[model samples]
Target chain A: MRFVLALLATLLVGTALGLAATRWTASNRQGFSAEQAGPWIAWPKAGTSEAEPYARAFQARTGYVPLGGGDGVALFALSDSDGRPLEGNCAYDVGGAVPAARFWTLEAFSPRGRPVAGPLGRLGFTSAEVMHDAAGHFMVAVSPQVRPGNWLQVATPGRFVLVLRLYETVLSASAFSLEADALPAITRGACR
Target chain B: MIFALPFFLGAVLIAVMVHLASLLALPGFATNDAYARLGRNAPIDQVAALTQAQIAALDLPFYDRSFETAVCKYDLSAGVLRLRAPSPDTMLLVTLIARGGNVYFSVSDRAAIKGLVEVLVGTDAQIEQIEASDKDDEVLGELRVRAPKPQGVALIRVFAPDETSKARAAEEAAQASCQIETL
Candidate 1:
């Protein structure tokens, strides 16, 4: 009877530990931040064999097909420049000169990876479509409410993530360690 | 007290082993992984254009709307997979993703010679067999990649500069082909 009880206890503890480990890994897979530009984090080795096991598991779970090393690079920002979590109720201005790239796009997604819904009927802005100033600089307004300039509508009263993708750019490999000044600045505006 | 300590230590060892095993097994056990999801929607050895609705439904993180994308589920055990696509004016990228979402090989439109991008994906043994059989360098000039796994995803991305060009980009992406070549 004592032996049976010990076996049962081991099994129970093992199973519990297994469950906890899986959960922890899934949530922490994005921990491998190869580069950081302000609040944005870039995982240069995300889709390669060199990626961490947790990153692989995260990619498997999220269904995100990462861009190839030679194709492009993707940067994600879950917080504003001040390191505060990007809340939907708050307004933000994402503007500045980006590094040299053939093209780029900025999108807003919810925690679940779906595009946030808003009144604009648009969820993102590409380099070609966004309005540029006379100085050839571009600024994007991210808010639940509609703004006059280039605006990317996001969900209100919630949190959202910003994904910036540079297509066919030289920033994939050697430029992974980009300075914060080289990238755009995401500044928080006002909040309701 | 000594006997109880041994039992507790054994249980702790078992828990640690279980934790490591679970961490390593999560990717294989995950059903909704990118490769699995793409496989479920598309048939093997054929390219499937992902509609905007389908892309949204998948909820894939970092899916750029500026590019039209297509996916092919490839199985090298059956035969080699042949991928062909025209070189677009802007940019066209072809990537091979393993079952665990690792990108093993990729090429851009700039690498295409003669306005065509051709890639053959197979195992190392299969690739060797093809190389051995074909003596002409002309036939083997097309890029050939050794896939790590027998099953995975072939993705093609076409750039669209603006909303107006999106339809054309999707059409171009649809024209890309993925076929099984028995070698």
Candidate 2:
């Protein structure tokens, strides 16, 4: 009976710790601000829609607007492929878990949230088609080089932003988990 | 008694885990509800039909943020449509757009102004008004700016973003895009 009690206590403690750890992880992830986190993070601002206000303000300030259209206004979050603060001119692999929805996309943006203009396309990628990794994680590569995988090549060296979008996430069961530490971090050979 | 100790410990552990998971998922759920409800106050036609076109042309994704549904309330007396997502917890976007361009946008939170302006005017044009309205029967939003006609007269009555008004704004944006001068 003493042995049984000890075993139960051990399991109980383990489970409790696991639960507490999850909360601690979330809190820790949200601690870093844009300045501390290298300016790649963007949370939804005030408005009926997410990312619209920021995108609009960015366009108004910079004279550049996010791509796609108003109907499918895409909202993206920037992170490294390895889940860390993003750096400029570094190679990064992007991937995430997306739930079942109408459509979703990932695109590369300049640090200022504008799509990076490059030979690869329009400085971003849309959901029409995306390559996945061996683990079924939606994967895209972001770098100055044009290699395999979902590549977002930067012609010039500068800070960049990645926008992961779920156009109609309103109807989906999945939710986004975007925090500073959770983002994939990639330091390209050039930056490294 | 020893077995009871283990059971108690196990129960505590389960409780802790449940609390943590809820903490992670709660805010997201709230934000999602707010977003979905905000979109509701407007006519479903404004956003729903664009699912296909928006996805293909705009590269928009239907992210797994929350459940999406269109909500609407028809005002029988006022004969107007009230639709919105649940962000500010007050007026919806459709109310703003439906109120028309000549309306005065009033908001107390300056932080919300930048965002509110974007929603009001598809273009993030600089807002050029700052004054208090004497009319007690006015609505409260972030920043209340009076729309001016060509002659600079403030329009007294403002309408929301009805289908026609939304279409007009879109057309104007498209036209402006085409007319941009290339250096």
Candidate 3:
């Protein structure tokens, strides 16, 4: 009788432990496939067949339609360069050079993945239109109020995400070894 | 609760198997996978550009909002899929995704030999049948990809680097066409 009880306990424990680990990985599995650059993280294998089992499982669970597969990779930032969680009220500066891609884009989204468009219908900036300093460095001001230079207006409230997609770049072949300086940085300004 | 050390070891073994098994099986049972979500609005063999509002409604995690995208869900069980899109510009990309969301093949506009990007996707047997029926080299002008699955989706992305090109990008994205022929 004791052996049967112990066997049942083992089965229950094993099932719970296994399922919990799976759940945890479904949310936190990027540790293996992701490469970090400053505050941004990109899963170089998110949409490819080379993606691992955990990555595939995560995609299935999240239904993330990755930026497709060829000629591009998307990096997302949930926090500032200093590692502070990004809030809607906080102003920020995205400044620096992205890796050499034929094209790239920058946009902010609500945590739920909706575009954070302002009343003026301002949502994001494309590589060709963003302004640059005299030294040829690019800077994008992320704020709700009006600002000078390139402005990526954030209109929604609560937590948000910044997605930087580099298309037709060499990173698609070497994302596993991307340098920290290859991408831009998110610096917090003032919070309203 | 005191338990035997052997039982604990056995539990660990079972746990490992359970974890691996779940990873392999989750996609099959995932109710909200990309295929399911894309199918919610994308009808079979029809290219539909994903609107920002529709994309928001889908609530995909970490989707890029700057790029214009179109999708065509296809079922090869019935016939062959002939996908064609204009590549008048340089920033177009097409990805063929299997049902479980694995991108089996990817191509860029640079490969568009005739300024018209065309491809034929079919299963192995279906391709053989197509080759036998086409008679000439009609399907040779573009890519011929033998799909590993009977059902999948094709994604078309157009990059708009600024406001000047945003309207053009949306127009290009909407031009993708997917047609299924029994031959």
Candidate 4:
């Protein structure tokens, strides 16, 4: 009788733990974040056949199609340069010289992975459409309020994520050597 | 209390072992994933052009508005899948994503010969059969990739770059074909 009770207890505990572990890993896995460019995290091996299991699970959960090395690189940032979570209630000044690429786009998304809709219906800024200063540097203002010159409105009242996609770039060849300073800087501004 | 301690320790050990086993098994059991969502509109072994509404319904993460995409759900157990697309004026990218969402292979327009990108995807056994059946050197020269999984997605993306080119891009994407080949 004691032996049967112990086996039953073990099976119950094991099944419960098994289900919980699967859920936890599926939700929390970030894949490879070894390469950080400023606040953005790039997974150099995200889409490859040899991708880590966690990466593959995350991709399955999010449904984001990651381009391979030869295609392009997609970098994601969940926080500001100061390491604070990116809140939509505050304004931000994002500017810097990015690594060379044929085309690039910067967009703000809600935590749910949809574009944060705003009043002007502008969801993102593209390299071809954004205005640049005399020195060829670009700046974008991210906020809920209306702003001038390369504005990506964040209408969400909660946390948001920034995705930077660089298309047809040579950076994939030397992704590990990329410096954080080479990418854009997101400085937190005043909050309401 | 002393008797309870042994039972508690035994339970903890069983839990830990179960947790590790579950983690390893999760990927295999994960259905209704991204590939499944993308494959919903596409029939197995046939290509389907994704409408804008369907794309919005999928709610895919980081989907670019500048690109028109198509999808094909392939099951290698049935037969080999042959994908062919004309090279777009701007850019054309084709990717094979396993059911677990890991991209096993991708090819771009730059690799196309005479504005055509043609690839055959199959299992190891199917590939061997194809090799034995096809004696033509020119046909053998075409790209053939082995799928790591029995079922997966074949995605084709064509860049539009602007609103004016959106229709053209969608038409170009529609022209791409995915068909099963019998060995």
CA-based DockQ, model 2 = 0.06
C-alpha RMSD of each candidate structure in angstroms:
2.5, 18.5, 2.9, 2.7
Error of 1 at B27 (Å): 2.5
Tell me the docking grade of candidate 4: medium
Candidate by candidate, in order, the iRMS in Å equals 2.4, 14.0, 2.1, 2.6
Instruction: Write the number of the candidate with greater DockQ, choosing between 3 and 4.
Output: 3
Best prediction by TM-score: 1
- Please provide, for model 3 over B4-101, each residue's C-alpha lDDT reduced to its tens digit, 9 standing for 90 to 100: 99899989988998988987888777778777787777889999988767876877676655667889999998899999989945488888877876
Error of 3 at B173 (Å): 2.3
Q: Write the per-residue lDDT of candidate 1 for residues A13-38, one digit (tens) a residue.
A: 76787778767767555635568879
What DockQ does each listed candidate score? 0.62, 0.06, 0.62, 0.51
| True contacts recovered per prediction | 0.70, 0.05, 0.72, 0.54
TM-score of each: 0.91, 0.36, 0.88, 0.89
Misplaced by over 4 Å in model 4 are A1-11, A173-175, B1-12, B132-141
Look at candidate 1 and tell me the lDDT of residue A2. 91
Candidate 4, B1-183: lDDT as tens digits: 787777777777877777667655666676666687898767887778987678879888767666788888888777888899899877888999888777888888887878889999999999888778775755443589998888999889887765667789899988889888877
The residue ranges of model 3 lying beyond 4 angstroms of the native Cα positions read A28-31, A110-120, A155-158, A174-176, B1-4, B88-90, B128-139
Please write out the lDDT profile of model 3 over residues A8-117, one tens digit for every residue: 99999998899888878875564266778789988887767677788788877777766545667888899999999888888899988788788777888876567787
